[model samples]
Target chain A: MSHNTEVLDQKTLWGGGRSPFNVSYGKLMIWFFLISDALTFSGLLCSYGFMRHKFSDTWPSANDVFVHFPFMGDAHVPLLYVGLMTFILILSSVTMVLAVEAGHRRNKKEVQIWLALTIVGGFFFLFSQVWEWAHFIHGTEAGAIKDIIVDGEWVTQVVHGANLHHNEYGNVLFGDFFFFITGFHGFHVFSGVVINIIILIKVMKGHMDKTGHYEMVEKTGLYWHFVDLVWVFVFTFFYLV
Target chain B: MERDDIIEYSLDISHTDEEGKVIRKRLWKVFWILLAVTIFEVGMGFMFAGVAAYKDMLMYTFIFLTVVKAGYIVMIFMHLGDEMSYLKKIILIPYCFFIAYLLFIAISEANFIFDIGWVLG
Candidate 1:
């Protein structure tokens, strides 16, 4: 019994009782979940790349498509609004990491402040996405005229905006992909805001303090950072590329 | 199996002022790097507009810069850099392989379809 107790004492830190990766169970699970989620996103992006490559000649340039800024009033500025959106998301990511850092210090006030900032950033990004999507669906004033067969008769029609079946943009797949990817990413940001709000409430209630740890905030930070990371890819592939 | 035992073992909080400063510095550095890369990407996008000859080059550059940005976000912001080296490898290696394989298949298959003129012709 004495020998066994001595071995246990020496191996306490490395024992099976602790995580092999030095991460808590919740954190490890979050990492794994993020990895799987990344694969799903990559799958979508790859399919988009394939379709874009296949329609290279007729692929609508993103610059020409996403050129509206709020209150800019028909002044064509390409990539500017999306650039602002990217800045917002990246800034939010910084604030989120700062929150995690403050949590590590057990500074409830700092954590709450940073978390609130993150939620605000997330709301801004989500609203921006809504505005961008509305512009995409509304399209430009001139629109595009295409001949389509209706009831066995070829008829010429003007299509102003985008839908699932047709787009004033060059290719139909362009609108589809845009809606799918950005809508999906927007959904993620919304969920992230909800999660951040929950975490903030918990912080306000001193739940983390009661537990004597702030690991929950860290887990939510991981998730928020993942959302930001996905936006980085989407901005590159969908807008810039 | 007590809650205190779990907290004591699992918490990796930095208690030192110097350590906190170091972490904050690193985080801000990463933020600056991400910002610079994004601005560079937007600038290049503007410069490459209507320049058909440089389309391929622009695409490649954007991809490269994006990968760099992703690296910073994943490593620093996600705290992967502070994890065990083996843990880092386990998370990153599979993603590297999966992305490469998917890109290869996507590019080659799309090229083949385009060459055949199956849809466009």
Candidate 2:
């Protein structure tokens, strides 16, 4: 991928020197912002890992635990439903890409259409998550995973009311963190979708075209892509392998 | 270094000139590379699943590959790579450090829980 200038490019990346080329201060600031944001997400995920490791022997298998809807009114099925949700999220990411394309061309109508699609996709994902949370909270109790050991390693072999309610899966800590982390992430996506929709409305009014800049679309696209990227990891770590 | 190169790099497929006229470039080359890498990823995901040498190790490899794909999209597709190297490093270092630190704690905490052996045998 390197051309004649590859060696020179390396001087910046390596050789203990700053960049040979100049970039804007805005772009550099954005980089720093993304860096901090990335750290926040990493910290949350890492905590999950710690808890997962502690429960390794009796840890719930993602597939098995996620199987069966809790409030399905006595239905029996597994995995297919969540798979559909994943498909929805990924497809929405594609639509966002289309919107980015349209924005580049100053295709206002096209941008609106694509943004609408992406917003719909976002809503669909959120709905799926809510359903999943309900099932997680009040659905079929997990099989492979049973009982909870407190932070001090005291196993509480008790089951009453719901899974996390009485003490089925483990102590309430898992449930607490689950709601907090996923809920926080979900809230972010929810807000991001709102912002995009607002921009879509503005684009329909021709604000971006009149201003001769589509930086809004570009910045929002970055945020959307990051959300999708985070979910890709969450899907693997939280749901699948 | 040409206009088309800049355009081609910014947009995935082709680009236009100053007058908004289409400028056909050999953009398919980049597409081919991306596709080839994606195929390798799919192959690795499936192949490594069965190796069982160390499940965690394979999982990390998969994560690494996924990061590579993401990096390509940002650097090539999003034009981030063309920016100043200082900018790129600043953004990437924090991101990597954040993710790494979180994952470290995740594994450590999970390990501590497993040692309890209170839930599963």
Among the numbered candidates, top lDDT falls to 1
> Residue B92: error of model 1 in Å?
0.7
Task: Assess the local accuracy of residue B21 in candidate 2 as a C-alpha lDDT between 0 and 100.
Answer: 27
The regions of model 1 sitting more than 4 angstroms off are A1-15, A147-155, B1-8
**In terms of DockQ, which candidate is strongest?**
1
Q: What is the lDDT of residue A30 in candidate 1?
A: 94
DockQ of each: 0.51, 0.21
- The residue-by-residue lDDT of candidate 1 on A107-138, one tens digit each, is 89999999999999999999999999999999
TM-score of chain A of each: 0.91, 0.76
Error of 1 at B47 (Å): 1.9
Each candidate: chain B TM-score: 0.86, 0.61
For candidate 1, give fnat to 2 decimals: 0.63
